[model samples]
Target: MVFLAPKKNLFNLYFLRYKFIFLTIGLLFVYILLNGDIRSNINVRKCFSDINVQNKIEDILLSERKPRKGKTIFFHETSCNIPDTLNHVRLKARQACAIESAALTNPNLDIYVLFASPKILNNQTITPILESILSYPNVYLRNVNLWSYAADTPIYEWFKDGKLFKSKYIYSHVSDFLRYLTLWHWGGTYLDLDVVMMKTIENIPPNFAGAESIYHVAAGVLNFDWDGFGHEIADMCLRNFQTHFDGYDWGKNGPGVITRTLHEICKTKQIYLMTRSRCFNFNVFQNETFYAVPYTHWKYFFDSDYLERTLEMTKNSIAIHVWNRYSSDTPIIVGSNVAYGVIAEKFCPKVYKSSGKYF
Candidate 1:
């Protein structure tokens, strides 16, 4: 009889032979799953200059006609590492709620929700949340190219040199820069994605930003028209951003830039005095107008016990900055007695109802 040799375990033999490779691939796969995107910091760096990259934005300065009625309200969605998973264009419930609140409250005011990438718009899928947001005739979703956006602006060189991706808070810093650039170019209202519009803001001062506190003037809700005082404020912000840009520090480039500009323009160290426009014409609204619930107590919006008190506190607020930095991880249960839920139900009923059990 022929010698019957036991069959070698080819799979185990191969695995053992390339165990290091397998381990590396396994770790990489796990990382992608955990991080939701596999692109490295290097890829982010490449994308900053990659014009061929599919994600792009339309030049609103060229395409969109100036609104004939109320001034345009702007909201920016910036993501450097966009995952290929479902449509990123589909706004999160919270984001949709925020947009819908603004759209519903200010029907006459043109609301532009600009995305940093075009992938979401290019996708064939139109998600429910997206449909709800688009239902508002005043609401428009457009893609924006950073290079094109920064072009003709003071920060153009900074972006051309690829310094934006170096920031630890890349998304926030890019947004901080874009807000000033867009406001400088078009002169409009810029609202943070985390804010919920409680009332119409079209009647508010043309160039205004709310103070998060006595010491800090938040950039979350900013309005700077393209000409006159608003133009002056936007110009100053662009100069300040270019003159003193810090990538490492979180707030330095954002609220810090605006705070510093306001200080210089108003010629005062104390921000509380800016509320009265003591030194300059730029209107600095009290914290209650936008930051009714300060960042330190942002959790109050999510707490059922504080729902009534928070609502009562923000009754006169034109908008509420939910301080997404502090309260994003906290869930807002649908139909719950939380301030966020109640506010969403009243202001963004469509988004709130579509959020199912949890928002």
Candidate 2:
């Protein structure tokens, strides 16, 4: 009985001495349970370390909402060359300039820049130019599946059959088809990535496009209303896209389809005559409004001497297509007095400033 009493006293004294340490451990456990992040333990952290996991998360976060048909401005990135290191779509300086300019010109409209291939975005992947454009509340960046984008539309079969991939000019042809599909699915203003908005297009006729020449209407700058005849034009263009698709002729599917459709609709060879004509439901603006500096004079954009002339020519232009096909190889030296440099500096200051030396 004496030995038992001594052992009991010893146990009681030891428990009392360490009671505060036990209490702290229990409280920490309760806190970990209360905080939901405890659920995101080692497994979650390990999963997030995978690039695909991060990409899927970003994809959902950046997904596009149902766009306002008439009020959305659409630009497409059809390239699939996402570098292994960069899972996000990286736009060139000129392309970023185009998007920012559109946002600047039409602050009320939603500007959508969709990528055809799946992209994973993170703080590291987003470049300064992309980050700058994303700062605009009206601008949205989304990764889109080309097949899903064309689904249920008349061009679905064509896209599914992989006809777009078999083209000699695959990227360009994909862009053309995607533009029509975009219009058919969600009617809106579709601009080529190379086209920079110089003025607000809010006042322009809802169903209008710029003429590339007296003979053909350009598809670079296109606006189709959400409903009524404009929608009808989009539908017809999709049908024509499928019916008259020719991978051999470069322009057959794009400019060719639009021009042919307009001729049939207006039943006039002189398509330019219908400009701003209230009698017809659709209008075509002069080439000077969009293609003021034509492809032939593409070099003028980089020439310092032509800066004043370029400004004068584009004074009345609502948008300018710098003919990326022709001028993409040409570099705009930073701090130069070239026309493109001046225009980009004023319209897309962030991208211009972020571009280190040349853009």
Candidate 3:
């Protein structure tokens, strides 16, 4: 009787163990089937991983630049860890370079380049470009160290506490914040590196606030009034940055946030948003019929075939933006050729007679 009882107990225990193993296996299989290959991808995992301020800035600084060779332009990607499935960084770099080249054409202008990099030591290749740009009277390079304050915080704590944020959010927030700050301290224009200046922007009226279109406040180019409203706008942007801790989609949200805030403040203060005849590009509400130019006007600015066609259509545009379709192999040679020809023939006749340098 005792032997029979022991065998029965062992059999029941073995059966229960097998059942539990099978149940666990079934649940795991179901999870994998439902989630696809998501668990296997490390990039997705890293996006949600805890990151410290120093580490975050380090990643942003280390992101690959296109051409692997050449002057590093005035723009740096925010380290948002958004999947680079489509090579978005390459596109941004190309667009930035195009803007830099275009901005360099004006002799009287000063180009200010802003970026956040982990490494404090200046890059060798970028040094020459900075030196070259600085040769002109007004160009300046400013590196804003974003991680200086929270360097000692742990990665996990920083992420959870909102001390660490994605790069895009930081960049957009900082840009808007700095724009207002600069105006409050010393007034000047805040030009998005994406914009190309077709005329002397120095002539922008002191009281004027520039916008691309009325419906869309083209943040790419802003000439602030720098008195009452400008100060308020800067303060609001800074406050939002400290509070939101996310939502930094530059293409969509950055300008939208600024415009909405500015509009609200303007209403309360009884300050009307001004619409200039030809000074700004984004104003859509002007009574006088104005021309709306495509961003491709800047992209194809240097392509001989495209330039010829564009010149025939509108010979005098102050600026054009190349929004997308930017790449390292962007036809700079072709574009520069057209630019030189146009500058010599129309805008600045002395371009050829001066330094006569070609990149």
lDDT digits (tens) for residues 1-359 of candidate 2: 35455888999989987997899999998898756443433222222222454554233223446678799999988775423444556789889999999999999899988766566667777888888898899988776666556778777886667555556676688788888888876788999999888899977768888788888888998889888888899989988988888877789988888888888888776867765554266888888889988887988888998989999999998888888988899888889999888888888888889877998
Clashing pairs in 3: 198-318, 212-281, 212-282, 212-283, 213-282, 213-283, 214-282, 214-283, 214-284, 302-335
Better of 2 and 3 by lDDT: 2
- Candidate number with the higher lDDT (1 or 3): 1
TM-score rank order: 1, 2, 3
Identify the leading candidate in terms of lDDT: 2
Per-residue lDDT for 1-359 in model 1, tens only? 79754557766667787998889999999988756433455566544332333444444645655433227888888775444332346678998888999999988788988766443455456677777887889888776777787888777876677666667788888889888887887787888899999899867767788888888889888888678777878888988887788878889888988899888888886877885347456788888889888888988999999978998999999998888888888987788899988888999998888877789
Q: Candidate 3's residue-wise lDDT over 1-359, tens digit each? A: 45455888999999999999999999999998656534333443344333343212223223342111111113333333444321111223333343344345544544545443322223333443333334454444443344432233222233344433334345455454444434433344555554444565555444233334545444444444444544445456445444444544553444554555455544422222433333232122221111234443544555677766655544454554444324224434312646424633333222222322432
On TM-score, the stronger of 2 and 3 is 2
Model 2, stretches more than 4 Å misplaced?
A: 1-52, 57-64, 82-86, 276-279
lDDT, each prediction: 0.79, 0.79, 0.41
How do all the candidates rank in terms of lDDT, highest first?
2, 1, 3
Q: When superposed on Cα atoms, how far off is each prediction in RMSD?
A: 9.2, 19.6, 10.7
**Deviation from native of the Cα of residue 200 in model 1, angstroms:** 0.8
